[model samples]
Target: MRKVGVLVSGRGSNLQAIMDRIADGYLPLEIAVVISDKSDAYALERAQKAGIKAAAIERKACASKDDFEAKINAALTDAGCELVVLAGFMRILSANFVNKWHHKIINIHPALLPSFPGLHGQGQAVAYGVKFSGCTVHFVDEGTDSGPIILQKVVPVMDDDTEDTLADRILVQEHIAMPEALKLWAEDKLVINGRKVKVLA
Candidate 1:
């Protein structure tokens, strides 16, 4: 099994989904460690409860962004993490850090991407009156949510849908897509070529 490190900054609902899959033997990857940028993030508790190594590498505690990411790199490297999973990790990693990890990092975004790239993607979709919105799992690159796509689950936008309501539905798909992408990665079934990701059967 490949070892992966998870980064989180919130409640860790996605982290819980992954943990559930791992517990049921559906995912072949092992969580080496979970690092949080906030000291008070609830994801740390979730990781510790699962008997995984967890740490808080607060960005504010470090002198610079480089220093903060260097500490994160050390933590992941020491834990032998082969992949980095971003689940509600609110920090925008520097280009240097992204290049260091290269395609080894993956993230789940709450929209189809190439449409709403940054924060509040679900809200953006709702505001734009799009007929459909969805969640995307993609490889992390230097750009914001502009990496090659791996997996996506579409959700139809309703006429009466508010941002919160639309976000709620998309979040469900996020839970599924993120784990599936990680599973594919663990099984070595993901192939990235330029701006595309091909999944092998």
Candidate 2:
């Protein structure tokens, strides 16, 4: 089984979804470690409950973003993680770090990426008035949410939908899509070519 590491900056509902899948033997992967930038993040608590190693590598503690990411890389490497999943990790990784991990790192974005790449994705979608908005799982690259897409699940954007309501809907799709992306990666079924991701049948 492939070992995976998760990075989170908040309550980690996505992280919890992954753990639930692992516990139920639905995914052929193991969560080796969980790292958070925030010391008070509830993701750490969830990791501990599952008997997984957890750490808080506060960005403020490090001298720079490079230093902070270096610490995170060390923690993941030490845990023997082969895959890194960014659940709600709030920081933008440096190019050096992105190159190091390459396609080994994956993230789930709230908006159907390429539409709303950065922060407040749900709000972006609502403001843009897109009828269909959802989540995307993609490989991490140098650019923000510009990597090769692995999977996406569309959710209808209702006329009366608030940002919070739309975000909640997309989050459910994130839970399902993230794990499916991981499974494809673990099974060596994803092929990244140029800007696209091809799943081998």
Candidate 3:
């Protein structure tokens, strides 16, 4: 079984999705560890409920940002995690930390990407009046949500949608998209060429 480490900062809806897929035998993944920068994160609770190992490492407790990442790196390594998944992890990992994972890390972003790459992606799309808004599951790189896209699911932006409503709809797609990305990744069906990701048969 392939082992992965998941990082989360907020509610772990995506993480729950991955766990659900794995439980159903739709994914060949074992969650080695779930780490959160916040002690009170609901993600940790989800992890514990699934009987998965959970670690909460506060950033302020570390000597520096590098030190913080170092501790996380150590945890992943100790757990024998081959891949890292960022499920709403808010921290921007250091360049060195990203380089260590290289193409082994993946993140789920709440937008089509390269459009509204930062936070509040749902709000950005709503404010921009776009007809379509969705989610992207991509490899993690040194850039902020600028990595090669692995899979994307587009959700139509409703005219009568608030941020909460749109995000709720997007979350449904996220649950589907994230599992697909993880399946492809574990099966070695994704190839990163430059900025593009190719899914092979």
Q: Can you give the lDDT of residue 79 in candidate 1?
A: 99
TM-score of each candidate? Answer: 0.99, 0.98, 0.98
Which model, 1 or 2, shows the larger lDDT?
1
lDDT of 1 by residue, 1-201 (tens): 789999999999999999999999999989999999998999999999999999999988999999999999999999999999999999999999999999999999999988898999999999999999999999999999999999899999999999999999999999898889999999999999999999999
Instruction: Give every collision pair in model 1.
Output: none
* Residue 58, candidate 1: alpha-carbon lDDT: 93
Per-model lDDT: 0.95, 0.93, 0.95
Model 3, CA-based lDDT: 0.95
Task: Rank all candidate structures by their TM-score, best first, as comma-separated numbers.
Answer: 1, 3, 2
- With a 3 Å backbone cut-off (N, CA, C), the pairs that clash in candidate 3 are none
Q: CA RMSD for every model?
A: 0.6, 0.8, 0.7
> Residue-wise lDDT of candidate 3 within 93-171, one digit each (tens)?
9889999999999999899998889889999999999999999999989999999999899999999888888999999
Stretches off by above 4 angstroms in model 2 are none
Report the CA-based lDDT of candidate 2 relative to the real structure: 0.93
The sequence of per-residue lDDT tens digits that candidate 2 reaches over residues 1-201 is 899999999999999999888888888899999999999999999899889899999999999888899999999999999988999999999999989897889999998889999999999999989999999999999999989999999999999999999999999899899888888888899998999999999
| Root-mean-square deviation of Cα positions for candidate 1 versus the true structure, in angstroms | 0.6
